[model samples]
Target: MQTLPVMHDADTEPLDDAVTRRVQARVGTVLRAKWRIDRVLGIGGMAAVYEGTHRNGKRGAIKMLHLELSVDPEARARFLREGYVANNVGHPGAVSVLDDDVAEDGSVFVVMELLEGKTVDALAEQRPTGRLGITEALRLADQLLDTLAAAHDKGIVHRDLKPENLFLTKDGALKVLDFGLARMREMQSNAKMTKTGNAMGTPAFMPPEQALGEWNRVDARSDLWAVGASLFTLMTGRLVHDAPTLNQLLLKAMTQAPAPIRTVLPGLPAEVAEVVDKSLAFDMNARFQDARGMQAGVRKAIAWLDKHGEPQNLVPVASLGTTSPGAVDSQMVTLKRDPTAPMAAPARPSRLAMIALSLGTLVLGGVVAFFVFGGSSGETPEPGPVASSSAGSARVGAPAPSATPSVAPIAPIEPARVAIEDAGAPPPVPSVTASAVKKGPSVKSGADFGEWGK
Candidate 1:
C-alpha cells in the first residue's frame, strides 16, 4: 500500500515534513529482527512506505503507521484492518498483504507485495496530452471494475478510488491499492470510527454523499461515482471539479454536477460518454446499481472501440515508461480514425439480418416449388414459352406457339447471393458472354427451369 505524493495545505506542511523526517531516519534499521528497511518509498498523511528485505531473502513493501497515529487505538486498528479488508476482496487485482507487525518504537506496519509498476497517475503524466488513449483508458477501467465488483460482492465499499490509488504493472496488470478508507458493511459496530460530520476521502474524487459526510448513504454506488470521476480525469487530464481552495473544491463536489465528459474530449464515443455520465448521476438510484452493471457498460465501450478499430492517437501503456513526455512512439501510432469524428456504422450486415435473409430465400424457393409441382397433385404443369435459338434470347411481340418445346435447365440460385441482394447490395453481373451463351444448350420451354429447382 504505497501512497503517492499529494499536495498538502500550508497549515499541514510542517507536520508532513516532520513525519517524513522521522520515517527517513528509519532507513538502514532492522524492524522486529525479521525485516530490514532499505529505503523510504513514499510518505502519506497516515503512513510511510519503505522497501523491506526479510531474513528469508524475500522483499516486500512495509507501510508503517505514523508514530502519532500509532498511539491512537482506533487509528492503529483501522490501519491494520486494511490487510483484512484487502484480502477479503479475493481478487488478483487487489495488492496482497503479506504480513503485519509492530516496530520497536511503537509504530505499526503492514507488509505488502512489492510491485514493479507506475501508478496510473504517473503513467498518464507521461503521455503527450496528459491523458490516456481511448483503448488504454478503457482497458484499465475494465480491470478496475472487475476488482471493484469482487470487493462489492463481499460487502466492502472502497471509500477512496483515484488514479493514484491504481497501479499499472510492467506486465500490463492493474492493481488496486490502499483499502485504508474502505467501509466494511458487516462491521456495523465500527460505524463510530468515522465521525458522523467528518468527511473522509480525496475531495476531487468524492461522490456527493461521501463529500457531505452522509456515511449512511455511502455504498457500492459511492465507489462507482469515484471510479467515474477518476476515469474522467484519466481521459481528460482535468479534475471533475477544480477550485483554488479545498473548501471550495468540496463545496463544488457536493453541489455541482461534473461537466459532461464530451465537453473535454468531444471526439469521445457517445456510448463511452454516456457511461461516465450515468455513473456521475447525483442520485444514487439513477447510477449503475452495482459494479457489475458499470462493468457491462465499460465492456460495451470496448466493443465499440473494437468495431471502429484503434484510434490514431492511441499510446500503449507499456511504452509510457520508456517514452519521453510529449514524444509519440512511431511503432505505437495505430490510427484507424480520428477519435473526434462521428462513429461510423459497421461495414457488414448484422448476423440476425443475414439469417433472416437466408430463411426468406428458402421460404420463397419453397413457394415457387409448390406452384411448379402443382401443390401435392403429383403432376407437372404445362410449359409457357421458350427461346428457339441457341442464343437464349426471348422473342418480342411474337405469337404463342401451338406446341411447347424442350429447354435447357436454368442454373441454381446461390443463397449467399440472395442474402447479399436482400441486404441492399448491388447484384453481381453475370460472367457469361454472348458467345458463351450461344455455345451453351438452348432454352426450348419455361418448364425446363423447374428441373433445376427439383
Candidate 2:
C-alpha cells in the first residue's frame, strides 16, 4: 500500500506516452538486407533501374522489370536469364550483375555495380572535333574487339552491338551493356521477334544476314560487320549506312560498299583505313573472320605507329580494294630513298639559275650558317663569297650543273589489296530473311524487324 504515495494516473500519462513512442519506434527496426532500392534512376522498355544500397551501405544499381512486362511469364524468364548471363559473363568491359530476385508482385529485379559513364550513343551525338584520329579510334576498337571476342568464344553472339550498347565508364573503361538479345549459338534461336516486326538489333549497324532476319545464320562474322560499322562511325562520326525503311536497309547491306575511310576521315593511315575497309565488306566472307582478326590488325597498326613516327605517310597497302589506283595523292609523290644505299650530294642550281644569274644570291642565311662553322676547321670547305649580277648579264646560255647523285629506278606503289568490285547489284539479293538497300552511300531497309523471323 505504501507504493510511493500513489502517483495519479494523469501524472503517469507522460511516462505512458514515452513508453508508447518507444514501442512504436521498435516497429521501424532496420533489418539486414542486400540492397535497398532508393529511387528510380531510369526507365527503359524492358526494365526500370533504381539507385540502391546494400545492407552495409555499398552503392549499386538495381534493375526491375517494368510493371507492364513483369507480368508476362516469358518476358520475366528472359529477364531473369539475362541477369544470370550478365553475372556469369564477367569481363572488365562488361557490366557486372551483383544480385537478383523476384519481388512479391512477381516482378524480377537485378542489382548491378553502379557505374558512372556515358553510352557510345552519347559520344556519337557529341562527336569529337577534327578528323577521327586513327590511334584513338583503333584503341576503342581494340577494346570492343576484346569484349566481342570473349562473348563469341563463350558461344554468345551479341545480336545488338550498336553505339548505344557501348559505354565508357568513369575510370575510362569501355563496357558493353544490355545483352538482352544476345544469343548463345549452342541454343536454338528464340521464336519471338522484336516489336519492330523483325529480329533484335539496330538497323544502322545490322549486317546483311541480320538485316534479312537470318538469326540462325548469324555467326562471328555478323559481329565483325557490326564492329566494322561501329569503327566507321567512330572514325567518321557518321553511320556507314542508313535507310528510311527496312527493305531499303537490307538491300544496301546486300549490295553497298562502305564509303572509303579517307572520304570522311582524311589522312587516316592507309593501313588502318584498309583494315576498316576489310571489316566493313558487304560479303561476310570478305570481312575479317572475327573480332579477334580485326583487333590483331588494329594492334599491328598501333605497333607500327609506336615504332615509327606519326603516320603522316602510310603507304597504302594492297589489302584495301575499295581504293582506286589514284585514290591517294601522297602515294603519287614518292619519297625516293634506299634502305641500303649511301647518302648522295645535295642538288645544285639548274638552267633557270644559268639564265637568271651566274651565281644565285646563295641564301644569306645558308651562307651565314656556312661561315659560322666554316671558319672553325681545317677540312672545312670555304664559304663562297655571295656574288650578285644584273638581269641576264652573264651565264645566259650555260648548262645547269648536276651535283646530286643519279637516282635509282624506284618501285611503283601497289594498289590497295582488297580491290572492291563495285559491290555488283546487291550480291544478287541472296535468299535470306532480311532485305536491305543501298541508298547513296548509306544502307537502308523496310522489313518489319519484329516479323522478319516469322
TM-score for each candidate, following the candidate numbering: 0.65, 0.58
Model 2: per-residue Cα lDDT over 349-426, one tens digit each: 556645344333333334445544555665765445443432212233323323332222234433211101122222
Name the top TM-score candidate.
1
Which digits, one per residue and each the tens of the lDDT, describe model 1 over residues 298-353? Answer: 99999998998755653323411222222311010000122344444435655666
CA lDDT of 383 in candidate 1? 62
Model 1 pairs whose backbones collide: 267-340, 312-335, 407-444
Best candidate according to lDDT: 1
lDDT comparing candidate 1 with the true structure = 0.66
Computed on alpha carbons, the lDDT of every model, listed in order, comes to 0.66, 0.53
